[model samples]
Target: MNIDQAISARHSTREYTTQAVDEEVIVRLIGAATLAPSAMNLQPWRFTVIRDQALLDRISREAKACLLETLAPGAQSERFHALLDDEHFQIFYHAPVLILISAEAPGQSVVEDCALAAQNLMLSACAEGLGTCWIGFAQRYLNTPQGKQALNLPQTWVPVAPIIVGHPKTEPAPVAHQAPQIRWIG
Candidate 1:
């Protein structure tokens, strides 16, 4: 698919099939991620791909627990708890691969660069006939020391986002929103 088609078709997929994504496909996704534009071409992003079921489960549990401990008692936290039930946690949409995006410390634009990389990965997944979900919620815990140790991430790398990838069980229709109101000065 072309870039426009991928942009139009890409959507967050919360459900996925049981099939596994091949290593080559993941490599292609990473390759696409690398093509994203970066500030000063710093390219400060790194990825950790998790495929082992036991490890995935451990990360999920730790993530949820960490959120529960830290998040303020608010509607958002309540909703998170409701959505991330035991069943949802068990399968994680049954996606075979979880890609953790991280950024190197030092640059002020590191977060933005990481976000760009994530968008590229998601768009590339769509082009490859795969589904992806950008999981920012996972960062709440994945940034912690326990999460760092769980993923064996380096101390200098800060976790930014996690993208879940697999064959989608259901495709979400595009969501509509009002166009942005901008003030343009020529």
Candidate 2:
């Protein structure tokens, strides 16, 4: 698919098929992510691809535990609860590939760079006939000691977000646009 088609078709895929994405496909996805613009051209992002089911389950459990502890018993907590109970939440609908995006600290623009890279990866995945979902809830638990050890992430690197990748089971609905809230000054 072309860039426009990819952008138009791209959406947050919550459900995916169980097929494993090929290693070559993952390489292409990362290549696309690397093309994202960064502050000072400093590519300050690293990705850890998780394919082991045991590790994925552990990460999910740790993340849910941390969420339960940190968030109040309200809407946020309810959402966490639902995520914990979701069959596809941690496993990405049993997709064999989970890419964890991380950034090294001591830099001011790391997070922004990582976000840009993530957007690129998602769009590229859609173009490649793959589905992806950006997961932000994993960061909280990933910062903890147990969570850190579970993923074997370096101390300098912090988990920023995760993307679940696989063949999409269903097509995403198009998003509606809202009125522009911009002011132009000449």
Candidate 3:
């Protein structure tokens, strides 16, 4: 698919099939991600690919608990608390693959740079007829000591985006987007 098609088709996919994504496809997508521009040419992104179901489940449970324990009591947090509290809430949605775009070193715009790469990866996955969803819930646990150890990531490397990849059971219908409000100053 073309870039425009990919962008139009790309949507956050939560439900996925048991089918596994091929390693070559994963690598190709990551390659696409790496082509993204970075601030000051730092290219401060590292990658960690995880395919272990048991580990993903464990991380999901731990992260949910962490979010709950530290979540401030408020109406805004209620929805999150309810969702995380659900026993069936698997953070990665049991996708066949989880790819983390992390910081290679601490610096400004590192997260932003990694985020750009993630967008590229997701869009590329869409073009390839694969599915990807960035799992924000997994980030908290992934930054923890146990989470770091589980991934064999170094102490300094920071996990930026936890994206799951798999075959989608069904393509999601397009959702309406609010039109952008433009203010031009010439």
Candidate 4:
């Protein structure tokens, strides 16, 4: 698919099939991600790919607990709390691949750079007929000591995006979009 097609088709896919993604495809996606521009040529992004079912489940459970413990009592947090209470809920959705994107530097710009890379990866995956979803719930746990040890990430690295990649069980219908609110000053 073309870039425009890929961009248009790309959406967060939660459910996935048991089929595994090819290593070559994963490599290509990462390659595309690395091509994203960074601030002052500082490519601070690092990626950790997780395919182990047990590890993913552990992360899901720990992340749920962490969110519950840390999030302040508010209506905004209720949805996540409910999801966590569901025993069938898996944060990674049991996808075949879980890619954690992290930044080596502690800066807002570094996080944005890593996010750009993630966008590239997702779009690339879409073009390759793969599904990807950025799992925000995994971020908190992934930054913890145990999470770092689980992924073998360094202390310097901070998790930016936790994305699950796999073959979608079904083609999802397009979601409606709102028009951009533009204010041009010329």
Best-matching candidate per TM-score: 3
lDDT of 3 by residue, 32-57 (tens): 99999999988999999999999888
Candidate 4 lDDT over 87-178, as tens digits, reads 89998999999988899858869888999999999999999998999999888888898888878889889999898999999997789999
Q: Candidate 4 at residue 40, lDDT?
A: 88
Give me the displacement of residue 64 in model 4, in angstroms.
0.6
Tens-digit lDDT track for model 2 on 1-186? 888998888888877777889999999999999999989997888988998978887777677767767777888778767777665566345667888888876488887898899999999999888888887677777767777788898887877768888888888777897989999999
Cα misplacement distance, residue 99 of candidate 1 (Å): 0.8
lDDT, candidate 2, at 156: 78
* Tens-digit lDDT track of model 1 for 44-157: 999899999788887877777676667778888788777665555643555789998899774788889989999999999999889998776688777888888998998788
Q: What overall lDDT goes with each candidate model? A: 0.85, 0.81, 0.92, 0.90
Estimated TM-score for each candidate? 0.92, 0.89, 0.97, 0.96
**What ranking emerges by TM-score with the best candidate at the front?**
3, 4, 1, 2
Candidate 1 positional error at 117, Å: 0.7
Q: Pick the candidate with the highest lDDT.
A: 3
Model 1 lDDT at residue 18: 82
Q: Which 10 residues in a row give candidate 3 its minimum summed lDDT?
A: 138-147
lDDT of 2 at 78: 85
